[model samples]
Target chain A: MSAVTAHGVIAPILVPLLTGTLLVLLRGSATPLRRTLSMLGVQLLLGVSLWLLLQVADGEILVYRLGNWAAPHGIVLVADRLAAGMVLLTSVLALFAMMHAIQGSDRRGRQFHVLFQFLLMGLNGAFLTGDLFNLFVFFEILLIASYGLLLHGGGAARSRAGLHYVVINLVGSSLFLFAVGTLYGVLGTLNMADLSQRVAALGPEDIGLVRAAALLLFLVFALKAALAPLHLWLPGAYSAAGPAAVALFAIMTKVGAYSILRVYSLIFGADAGPLAGLVDPWMLVLGLITLVVGTLGALASQRLALLVSHLVVVSAGSILTAFGLGGEAALSAGLYYTFQSTLVVAALFMLTENVARTRGAFGDELRAGPMLPAANLLGGLFLVLALAVAGLPPLSGFIGKVLILKASVGAPAAMPWIMAIVLITGLLTLIALARAGSTLFFKTETHARTASLPNVAKLVPVAALAGISLLFVVFASPIHGYAQAAAAQLVDPGGYLEAVLGAGATDNDADADTDTEPAKMAEVAGPRRTTVHSPPDQIMPAH
Target chain B: MEALIALVIGLLAGCGIYLLLRARTFPVVLGITLLSYAVNLFLFVMGRLSIGVPAIIEPGRSAYADPLPQALVLTAIVIGFGMTAFVVVLALRARADLGNDHVDGREP
Candidate 1:
């Protein structure tokens, strides 16, 4: 590839990293200066991400090798349709969330701009990396930055929630290491493209070990995505975090979903001999339970913030269920739904902050409050977001749900159950949000005091996000087409592998060359079959 | 060697889980630290316990030890250290602010 295209691939990661470093070096500067710097950097990031999305919209997978080292030897960043789309979404979310933070929350803590930049860096890095080990490193970067952001305002509740969030993630990080290690030990490669090829060629005895490693990786991701039974940490953390922080976190769960989709489809895909259908059954069962629990949690929640957090769980469940159903159509629909829910939930969080500001002491609690100043405008925004999140008509959420339902028709066994759970969750969400809405906005008590006016800067981002979500409805067909193409790319890993490695990397000779190393390890480690090597030329490109 | 490494990992994980389930914050922090140690060692051994082999490759050499896992383990160790430090400070802050060190930040 030429230098410009190469830069395009790495720009998403480099821009944020360099910006974060600059902000840290320029610490103690005026708050206005820092905010200006952050805004310029994020806006540039958004431009680059949009350019990348357009570049990859034609089914091209862009792979940039770091330091001129080839795929298997050096770290490579791959920007295919899925990765590019996610980066674009993240940039959009980051821009609005930063705007919201700049309105006030950035003043509450030191280095808020610096931490936000680093968090963006980590997020972009995670999406673009084509190596499994690099993913872990990026995950840490994001987690550490998130720890700072979560505790930014310095409250009792935030610190308490940050404690649980940090500890659980630490444990999850450990498990992630174990899983990567095991997979590396068995396969002798950490590059994702090479791993997929090697996995397909694994001998019978090696399947069990690889299967175990795959399942462990799934557990780590499940914890991150807040699937049922493992979702204990999400509600507490999201509910207690500052509104801007929580809004940005709307994309964080999608990272887990993205990883699951990437790893499962790429590594243990249909070509894998014994591991083809390993995670689908488990994902289906857990997904259904998560949907039920999330809806019930929303219904039973006493606070609006917690209710939105539960809706996040419900979105994750919906995406996972579509993934478990396992077809190109369903996967496409899941991607579309993922995009819709992320934007709407983020907007909802921002709206919650504004509504809470208007309620004075009532503060987002589901109790009677005085008439909110500008009740009509704020109430209208909340109504639109609530309707979208509840998957009602005339919004992208309804279209997304329709796509998922239509796609799942192929999976006869799961179609009925998935539809039932999804519709029920939608009804529950509508009821809960409607009740909270009326209690906060419509009900007026005589003795209640009026709160201060909401900030225009704060309100603008929420309006912008809601507007974009509505636009998704206006342009659903083209967006769904893009999602369909992205899902097709996901199902077929060969294009990605070719883009990362060389053109003929899929041939049997390359597989044989790498197979011998793992076979030798297996022989020394256990009673496993061994394969022979052809030559090194078939594997790595010479300098 | 494999059996011994597995035993050590199991022991560390067992202790980590026990402490993680405790009601107090300090033990939970310690639990995460121990678990990270176990994970780091686990990643290190993924290269299959070769001794006296150079990690770097030579033109005619065919038996160099794998260095990728070592690099990965090193990265994990640094991250784990940073995490431990941050969480310790966070625990201290929680204790100071909430006036209790229970993992939930309130007296149980």
Candidate 2:
């Protein structure tokens, strides 16, 4: 591999870190300068991520070791198809979010550009890191930035929502540490590639503890993904966020889904004899319940932003339901749905803000309001976004939902329920969006247009997002092809293992050590890996 | 020693969870703080309790305590500290802005 390809794995994390620090240092500088710098940073991030995606397009997993430390001993950032694609998705979403924030939302808050860059850094770090503990650190980074962004405008409602968001995530972080501890206690490594090998070799004595740890980790990710029973904080927290912040927050939930796909499929995969497919049944049931609850919530919402937030939950449900089906095709379908839904939901958040801007005192409420000045432009934008969100024909949402439904045929028993809930949720979303549209656009108080026209500059991002959704429909084949490749890479993580550790590393001496020490599980677990690595030749690869 | 550590962790977690379920923001923040303390201790113990052992590699050392969990706990402590500070400030702000301390921003 060329030097750039070898070292490019760290660029996505470094670029945003440097840019965020620069923005913070230059806080007293001109807003225009800061805005320009932030935009350049996000645009550069998008470029770097796209380049990384292309590098890994042929299914090469690139591992960047921090401090030249080898796997199982030091932190590494691995970029495979899934990680690269998710980072690219975040970069694309961040660019549009920056476009919207620069239009004026940044002026309403302190350090908007700084916080935005850190959020990107956190997201990229989370996607790329190969260490499970590093994943927890990145989760904290993103959550802290999100807390600041969510309360950027600072209101009673936002404060209320921010409290719940902060506290719940704090608890989640605690749970995450507990899980990490248990896993490390039982298996002697935090590196995911290493853990995948060790988890499979775990003795029967360690199975129950590892199972609990894995499930606890799942619960935390589910809370982040806004799956049911644990999804109570999403609508309130999302709706209360500032427009640009909410737009970026769309990918944050996908981070949870990404973790679920990564950890569950990699470590607790079909190869792990006792713990194989541990989360599959739970993922499906909770996913369907989340769909039902979210769709009903969307229908009951009295405000446009709340409705959009509920739609986000609906998308999460759909994507996870696809993932829960557990196969290459289902995962591919879920990935495609994730892409389109993120873009469309982000556009919906911005559109709600635009509508609220045009309606003066009746900000985003679904009740009848004064005639909007740019009714035609705004209404048309809302129509396309609503259609895409509701999974109607000729839009990307329809294509995604259809792909998921087609993939569900693999699981015979869950297929019917999946079909029923997914279709019913789509129908309910349609009804909700229809009601929100007419109430905002048609049910005007009077024909006399009183509210001022929204800035065309602000509408550009919304229009771009909607236009991309349309483009998604046009380019579904190639994009879905990429998703399929990524899914295939994910299901068979042997490449990931080989790239991070050396070739044939899973058959290392530690596997034999663990097998003989089953009786003294606790005492043996701590020093076994260390003993295996005492001879330097066995630890580091001959790179 | 293991039993004592486990008991402490269980007690702290039980109390933290109970406080977290309360309606007030202050108690909720306190609950999170207590829970984090419990988690940090729990993580510290996961490395296997060893006394007077080197945490790093050295000449002629055959036994060393697992140092990664200490490193992990240290990182967790710093993050938990930052989050607690932020949440505390946020709780005060929520109280000031909402004219109440209830998590839902209203007297129930």
DockQ of each: 0.54, 0.59
Off by more than 4 A, model 2: A447-449, A506-528, A531-543
Candidate 2 has an interface RMSD (Å) of 3.4
How far does residue A184 in candidate 1 sit from its true spot (Å)?
0.4
Please give, for residues A244-338, the per-residue lDDT of candidate 2 as tens digits.
99999999999999999999999999878799999999999999999999999999999999999999899999999999999999999999999
Q: lDDT of each structure?
A: 0.87, 0.90
In model 1, the runs with Cα more than 4 Å from the true position are A509-518, A521-543, B58-62
Residue B40 alpha-carbon offset, candidate 2, angstroms = 0.6
As a whole number from 0 to 100, the lDDT of residue A225 in candidate 2 is 96
When candidate 2 is compared with the true two-chain complex, its DockQ is 0.59
Q: After superposition, how far is residue A73 of candidate 2 from its true place, in Å?
A: 0.7
Candidate 1 clashing pairs?
none
lDDT of 2: 0.90
Cα RMSD for predicted model 1: 2.6
